[model samples]
Target: MESTEPQRYRFTGHERVFHNVSAIEALPEVMALFGYQRAFVVCSRSIRRKTTWIDRLHARLGDLIVGITDEVGEHSPLSNVLIAAKQARDARADVIVSVGGGSVMDMCKAMQLCISENAYDRESLLKLQFVVSGDGTEMLTTSQAPAAIRQIAIPTTLATSEWTPVSTPIDDETRLKARFVVPDGSPEAILYDPALLQQTPVRLLWATGIRGLDHAINTACSSSPHPFASLLAEKAVALYIRHLPNLGDTTATDSFTQCQLATWYTGMGQMSVPHGFSHWMVHIIGPYGDIAHSDAACVLMLAQAKWLEGWVTPQHDRLLAAIGQSDTPFHAILHDLLAGLGMPTTLDDLGLTRAQVEAMIKPALEHPLVTRNNVRPIKTAADLRAVLDLAWRA
Candidate 1:
């Protein structure tokens, strides 16, 4: 069931969309086409080692590969972002190409702002004027003074970070969570190729698929659910259910295409309402335990959704139906899906102890976005502790 969540906030930007069959064929042309003479390609070490697509891209683009950094991890820490920005500056790159999952994309987006001098200092990143009252309007805003650093995104994992304007990063000095600098820095081009994702480890694909699902579920059941966002979320859930199960056996080009599109849809949906408790908790868990973002996300989804059941309304049921599942207790169906996919439906599976659950109370409650969006207010540490107790044990 949905809550009587008031609709507030307006979304911005045009969807600059593109899809290609091969990264080799598309990378050079897209770069050249977008007038990006040279770009800094940022990826994760895991991604670089597993896939030869970047090598092929480098071969195709040649000198256009102005700089390369593969240090992206679960979160784009400020140190990494600064290192990347320095590398881009050294290379004199005018464009940024990110070629992994959400983390890589987040890093790239942040680097774009940093390299452009819009947010030269980390402290200044948190002080930008938010365009809260605009309706799909574009304005030329400056931050330390805007310099051109175009973005070209090529996401390999299904975590949909490409569709958002913000990036999550950890502060270099303080180690506190910080959002990467972004205002009017949407990607100039996006290239989605399914084969590159085929190189992704099966476990990561499975895990990120769950993260994609969380995006949809959170958006559908969000306090301010929009019809457009709900449609994207519903489609994402249905596609995720079908493709993720047979991800190993299925090599059909269409399967990967569907997964890519679903992730994009989920990304767009999430950019509106953002994520809720599951995401907040997962974000904390991944960095604290040094776990994969997707792994942390999948493990927490069912438990968090189960917790949400207590607060659900009829609108939640309608959303479940819209996502191609009949509205019986959604927690049961979601748990079954998790079990079948070999994802942990419980927190204990991740090696969290009762003590760790107790520890999660403060961090989870402290996440401003998730804490604020909760339909049921988290009034005190006691309230969050009670929820985490159930989530921890489940």
Candidate 2:
């Protein structure tokens, strides 16, 4: 039963968005709009070493690029972020231009916070994060105001970090990820070029497509669902179902653009609604088990759907309909889609032991975001362990 009461929707708008082949050409105009002169570029070493895109971008930006750092690691670790922040500061950067995957974008966002707030070390950065209370309540902490500098994201994957105001950076000592939520943490602009996306590894692109799918599914089924968000999420689901299968073909540039559009829709949906178990579980799994964020979705989404079996709302039916599988069960349909994409469907497939899965329960139960935003109430560690047990196998 859907609620009939009126609802409100709000989003932090980007200064500009460019989504076509001419996206790279629009960077100068966007920089002018933001009054940004000196740009510091952040990306992964792999992108810089293996691709000529960075060189082309440099030729385009010319003298505007003050510095470039390609040392961003897999999970945006705290140590690497500090180094990037110092590099940006030393360069006297006026803005950040990130041109890689989610990790690079996350590193830039974290660096922005650290540079603005004068949190130069791990202790200071950790002090700025929200913490979970003994009773599983999240206590959010606010920063001073907006940072002086902003970021421009040109994502090469479907992880959709470009559209969110949240940043997750892993701590080196604790080996746990911490969430940083600043009102102005979102990028000022986003460029989604299909040619740039074509440069990404097919396996990586497919994995992140599952990540976007997770965003859409979780948003549609959120406990506090908004009608507008549901509509966007439904469209995102349809787009992915239609385009993701064809994305592996090098000639399918149109498919790449469509998938990018789907990610944008799901990214908005994620911002509009709180996520559930799969997202929360993946955050924990990524750092603890050394799993990629998107790969964790491959292993956990089915089990999370199973946990929500009887608890799911009519939105599940809408999802089934969007995927053209109205008569099929949601979990079965999801499994088949993942299998088709060559994604892992179980923890064993990801090379995780049952004991490691059990170990995650205590931390998952205490995680602020996991405890606060789950559609299904997680009352105890036992409840989390139950879900973990199901997720441990296919």
Report lDDT per candidate: 0.71, 0.83
Q: Which stretch of 10 consecutive residues in model 2 shows the poorest summed lDDT?
A: 132-141
Q: Write the per-residue lDDT of candidate 2 for residues 1-394, one digit (tens) a residue.
A: 7578555565756777778755568888888988999999997787789998888889998999999989888889999999989999989999999988889999998898888888889988887775443433223336675686789998999978888867888998999997886556779999888988988889999899888888888889887778888999999988987888887898988999999999888877677666778877889999999999999997778888888877875888888888888888888878888889899998998899988888887888777667566667766887787777777766
Per-model TM-score, in order, reads: 0.88, 0.95
lDDT of 2 at 25: 86
Candidate 2: the clashing residue pairs are: none
**Which tens-of-lDDT digit does each residue in 1-394 have in candidate 1?**
7657654433534236676467668777777776778778998787777667678778888888888889876578877887888788889888888888888888887777776664556666655523322422122233554546767788778877777666667666654466443654566667888888778877778888888888888887766667778778888888887787777654666778888888878866676664567766776777666566777787667766766776866646775676567656777777777788787766677777777667656766665544555555554787666556555544
> Which residue ranges in model 2 land beyond 4 Å of their true spot?
1-6, 131-141
TM-score of 2: 0.95
Model 2: how far is 108 from its true place, Å?
A: 0.8
